[model samples]
Target: MIRTPASRRHGFSLVELMVSVVIGLLALLFALRMVGGAEQTRRSALGGSDEMQNGMVALFSLGNDARSAGYGLNDPIIAGCNTQFSDTKGYQLAPATRGTTDVTPLAPVVIEAHGANPDRVTFYAGTSIGGTPTLRLTSDAAAGATQFDVDRIVYGFNQGDVLVVAPEQPGGDCLLVQRSDSDPTATRVTVAADAGMRFNGGTPTATFKGYAARVFDLGPVGSLAFRSWSVADGYLQLQATGPDDASAQPSTVAEDIVSIKAQYGFDTRTGSAFQPQNGLQVNQWSAAMIDADGSGTAGDAADWQHIAAVRLAVVARSKAVERPAAGAACTTTTAQPVVFADAAPVGVAAVPTTVNVAVTGDPVDWRCYRYRAFETVVTLRNAGWRPNP
Candidate 1:
């Protein structure tokens, strides 16, 4: 097939070769565009998924804790100022549950005064009350046993678990002690040297069947938990103060949580005739009376016991930014659509309470990203079981 250069047949015209090259380039550009679009779509989907997962986890944790609030305490709800040992609400019998402001614990009345409000909820509970007792003393109660012979340890009762020994029969005395020896063998537990001998104003003289003991694990050893949730730097954080520790350090629970709002459900329906169709009503603390002294106020502790449920709402944003189509109605001025009143009306006898956190500092163009909202009404099981005071 050899031929002379001139006879090699003129390859093709320069213009024709240029046209072929241009077509090939166009096909390659089209394929590149498709790949880029697919990648962007994948990223958006993954971002939205992450946002949803975070929201669910946050809600679950908050709700679970709320249900167990005020467990094993004498009273389900205790007034912030009430120092009455009998009426104190918590496992340790202090003012167990308090809805305080970011600065100080506020009565329901002054919660909405601040423009951006975050609540610090502090409470404690025993390991279990309704279910089968996990840790019960195997020895009888007389004056005191050097070490506790527990029936079983469900989760490996660690050292420092607050132990409360209560008598099976009413009127018998109990004891509150902190476990000292670190033994996960589920048999014997050593008690602290300074453990209280008289529980509930009496000493234990009954046998193992006569008295039972339960442990309260407050995260760290030898401390009651003072757990709180707040938003900082666009992340929802959970913090706790050990019984021994005064301050709490927050750990991020979820990212991109912009705001949190809550409302309390009070069991206001008293007597069948006066009761509304719904047994629950929102409590704004407007009707609650305040007593500077920690005395037994009429409406303060009285109203706290009526708290039956809590409605919580939170808003989260996708981690990745998204671009909307041109001319799309994608614009949001504020973090949320609802209007948050910065100032309450003067002399307002009863303003509807709206427990919410307002995020300030940097405004986010919420329209540029995907958003998810999580809301649930959590029933306080312990509170519900208690009758209205």
Candidate 2:
């Protein structure tokens, strides 16, 4: 077939061309599939990261608040004063569970005289507006206007500061307030939040920070009850009531335990050699409480100067988070949250730990202590306790 080369040109047949087209289409489809799969993987990874970060933040918040639990009238007031309300109120509400009206009283630690007022907040029965609970404050806690209006203003401020609840100043719309211990109200000795100011208002009028203090002076359960006091064994001990029940009685609530811890300060050893278990010895307490120098309880409650410092610790933890399961890849791995008490290092603050039990119905998530377990010794010798000199 050696015909003239130009005349005998050879090329692909129609069938062959169609077959090529099909092959090309198949390759394109495979590439697209790969790209879609990659995008999906990236989205999944990002979602996991967000979940972990959110869980961490929630846990930290729970820890901070829980740590401050049980810091009674004499506990360390790291932020505010331990003012015993003479006869006033701060926060009153029908708690999630309770029996009496919760109240926060005024303390001698007057923070102000005539500057600003606290915002009075009241939440009660109301119409469901926009699918939400609706309630307004009819009484202004701190209005300073000429005609002081509103009836009784209830209040529950921080646990250790002087918060006053009184009638809006006679004529002014704003109410008179004091926070420090040096209040000038000798006759009245009352601190009043105008119920007309914000919590973080620029002036001394503000008391509560991110969250308001629970100052209920009632039984084990009260809305205003931040912490409760009871005599266990002739010892004045306190515990968190409403928000600080960490033992998980009945059934555990969301991070049901925020924080809880305690400290003990004793006076110098008076009669005999001290034993770590018998409790604090403050009979003839030394200048410093807790027997940092081995003394007894030298201070008295009547005068702020009578007693020395005491023990204090705060326990906190976040509400429990939803748990996920482990798979075949996690065969030999343990499944549980590891707490400090469990082979954890000291000062180790962490969230729930997960081990792979791979069992049918055991909890994979473990709860950390509501309160970071630590104790701090305080000395009220010259300041909070009686004359130690």
Candidate 3:
């Protein structure tokens, strides 16, 4: 309120005050932007990392098991992986089984007798769960139906079943399963629980398991997806369902999965390419070869047993961890075609698709980064493993 000449002169000039205010605002905006960018980078990195790790776990883990696909269960080891279990209609022969006094690993075979008829020899996988299946002979599925299950005896696999973390429920439970006799002790079990079974009252003679199992083929020319070992003729099969409360399908957590891509592998050196028993030529490289058909003729193809390497890829999509635009919608389509050649003579016309969604998941929080890409090589190593046939 003073009107003294000295007081008036001391007051700040209009331009000086305006400049100071502008400077302060500019600093505040710059700090905010830096903080925001750092957060975004972290989120992106996190999403990528999560997907990469998941993919590695899937490929490497399976590769480790497949390397042992067929070991000590075939003649000349690698060569016998393609041997047929049986050609009879009455019943399929046993898979991996305890070797008889007369049987030797050199001539690994499961002989089944139809009473007076001579015993039939079949190749299979044998696994060890509660107790190690030293030498398991391949046996048929349930008496009435043709479905693989944890039973006293199996028809296709011997002791070579795979044991690893499940694709759907990794690190959840543990189990002992069976694959083909030719398979090593690699892809049989499907448990992440502590090794060994629980003998509460008494451990069930068998346990449920699914390892390195995948949608092998979608029939010769149908959209119907089948497991690697599915054979309409042999009839013994397993079905994989979508997310569910029960075990068959778990991990409904959307963001948990980033991306999944699969291709068939074959014996390239064979000239004929790696073809399964059913006579389907495989095109891509693979860590392990499936029987193709329940006919159980993996080891039979010397080329397959000789395979050396495989090609694998995994890509996952997570929600933007901190998308400035939260309510943003993502565009997804099933038409995103994945064309996989039919291996040889006849190829699939239309490209089969995996999945597509429009924002069902969200990105992770900022701070940590998630690697996005995962690529690897799986070499065969086991009692009787081969990558180049």
Candidate 4:
């Protein structure tokens, strides 16, 4: 082999090697930046999808229950009574009250306002197919009486049927009991605290004195719909008093629900003597019932009866907490969510409302999470079918 000149045998120089290493580092840095951006976009998309899903589910579930309100509770005499009940399975209902006193009238739907916090909405309905015909008590039912004597034989009632023993007046207290024995042609119905009946064994907080009372059938115990909806621990929860529920404790309906706001759509029109006309058109929207009849009292039975529809809004927050650059404030959420943002219906009077998302003792600020709001106006069809007082 002939010996070649060293100058002819060329190889990479140190400068060239350094330049190549620098180019490789630049490419890696660009790739890393692209990956980071893609990951952020993916996370945002996922968070938004999750929020939408949760909000829709919350709205649908609430609307479905609201539509069924007053199904078997359309009788005006018991529409706004403070109902008392006992359940051995730890089931309890929020008592109806106007102020500090126990003048809370039972209604198909009752909204408990909590200022800027989430509101609680309770719905009452029955599954009776008999259409809310009152069964008059032929005799007075004394306190602790287990049986009720009606004028005629109980035809549609069955064992385990829930009944509301209400006074003839609208504002009196009512008793809720489950029928322990059913006889088709019997004039007397028994509500004894028998075994296997969860709603009949516990002692009621108040004694029931039903004189000239009327019994409103709420269908079978398992079919009754007495549910309350509220938001707690960033979740939409439901507490059901119906015997069909597996547990008396509140169950989580959806996650990431931050707030719930509701308003009653009332038909304020009245006829002669200041009687409610029960019109179909809603004229006012309010969180609580107003004295529509100038009766000097708010949230009376007439006010509750005038509620033609319910307007609801629910806010859902993204699960991921977006972080900001070092020493900078988060830009993910700049303002609190709003409800009733648009102008009220053409003839309705109302104002917009804001929701508070801040939670105490939370490690991350609520502003770091994105939010979505779902809203709907549900007409209470059963309102039109309510029997006259």
Least lDDT summed over 10 consecutive residues: which range in candidate 3?
A: 215-224
lDDT of each: 0.48, 0.27, 0.30, 0.79
lDDT of 1 by residue, 1-389 (tens): 96668834788778889999999999999999999899888888898898898878877877777776655442322222233111012222322223231111112211122223544333444443243133656666446554666666635455555555544332233445556667666576676454431122223343334235333332323244435666766688765434432332567888877665555555554445222223444433221223312333433444454555555556676777676567665543234433222222223123233433334564544566666767766665654443332
Name the runs in model 3 displaced over 4 angstroms. Answer: 1-4, 7-10, 13-15, 48-51, 71-125, 128-255, 268-310, 317-371, 379-389
Candidate 4 vs. true structure, TM-score: 0.92
The top-ranked prediction according to lDDT is 4
Tens digits of per-residue lDDT for model 3 on 26-79?
999999899989887776677566555554664453344344433432222223
lDDT of 2: 0.27
Please identify model 1 stretches exceeding 4 Å from their true place.
1-10, 74-225, 242-247, 270-299, 324-364, 387-389
Q: How close to the true structure is residue 381 of candidate 4, measured as C-alpha lDDT?
A: 84
- By TM-score, the better pick of 1 and 2 is 1
lDDT of 2 by residue, 11-81 (tens): 77788899999999999999988996777566545544543443344334323333332222222121112
Better of 1 and 3 by lDDT: 1
Quick one: ranking by lDDT, best first? 4, 1, 3, 2
Candidate 2 TM-score over all chains jointly: 0.30
